[model samples]
Target: MWIADQWKDYEVIDTSDGEKLERWGDYMLVRPDPQVIWNTAKKHRGWKKPNAHYHRSNKGGGEWEFFDLPDIWQVHYKTLTFRLQPFQFKHTGLFPEQAVNWDWVCGRIQKANRPVKVLNLFAYTGGATLAAASAGAAVTHVDASKGMVGWAKENAAVSGLTEAPIRWLVDDCVKFVERE
Candidate 1:
């Protein structure tokens, strides 16, 4: 069980009633979590008046109710910066728990004596790509969605990795893998 406890800009405040209240930078968001089965008391005040709430529908989809939330926001993890936006599937474009993975990715690339090349497939928002690039790896980030690839580019720029060796490609991972 890897715990991502190094986050200063993101925190899981509390969990209750199939929902997790999270603090992303300056905003609080209530999102659904299937693992939170226990009906714990929602002691956190952020649960009541969060900046945004993703209400899940029993019909197989959900909708976000906003309360003064911006269309986009930024969060930092170590030397990386990620742009977050609540899109389909209740995703905020970035997964805070993946910070642990990012740390491992960075460490592996840094430990490599020579220049390393990383191929990130289905690289949603380029979390791992940025991590590898920050550690001096030339990374090729591939994703199926063009918007997601663009979003990753913006994140790279904000994280000061715009000059890093990264190749952004918008392509289906399966097809790209087969073609490559």
Candidate 2:
């Protein structure tokens, strides 16, 4: 198992009882985790006063119980910026763990010396596409949701990449790939 130890703005405050208490750039949130089965007491003080809690349902989905969370906000991973909001799905428009891959791909693109054209399939919210664009690659970002495609455009704009050669497409990734 590869472990990362370089994140300065995120932390896992505690994990127990099938839940993870995390701190994301000043906001503490508690969310469910199927990997954690031990019912240990949360030692972190943030766990007692998380800004939001995601409660799971027996029927298959879940809901968020917010405390002092804002309706929307922004965060950064190095040079890339992202909008964060508590949505019906347990997502905040950004996946920080993928920063490692972003850095790797960006480095490869920067060193390639040739014009790089990237096709991003299943490009939810365009994180990978934005990363490639930031690294000076022309990218075609494809997703099924128009809203997600719009959000990705906004993220690109926030990262000062609106003029980057990125083609945003609202289409099913599998179907698009098959057609291509």
Q: Which residue pairs does candidate 2 place in steric collision?
A: none
Instruction: Give TM-scores for every candidate, taking all chains together and pairing residue i with residue i.
Output: 0.98, 0.93
Q: What local lDDT score does residue 91 receive in model 1, on the 0 to 100 scale?
A: 93
Residues 103-169, candidate 2: write the lDDT tens digits: 7789999999999999988788777998899999999999999998998999998889999999999
Off by over 4 Å in 2: 1-6
Candidate 1 accuracy as lDDT: 0.93
Model 2 error, position 40 (Å) = 2.5
Candidate 1 is scored at a TM of 0.98
Tens digit of per-residue lDDT, candidate 1, span 25-144: 999999999999889888788988999999999998899999979999899999999999998889999988988998998898888899999999999998999999999999999999
RMSD of 1: 0.8
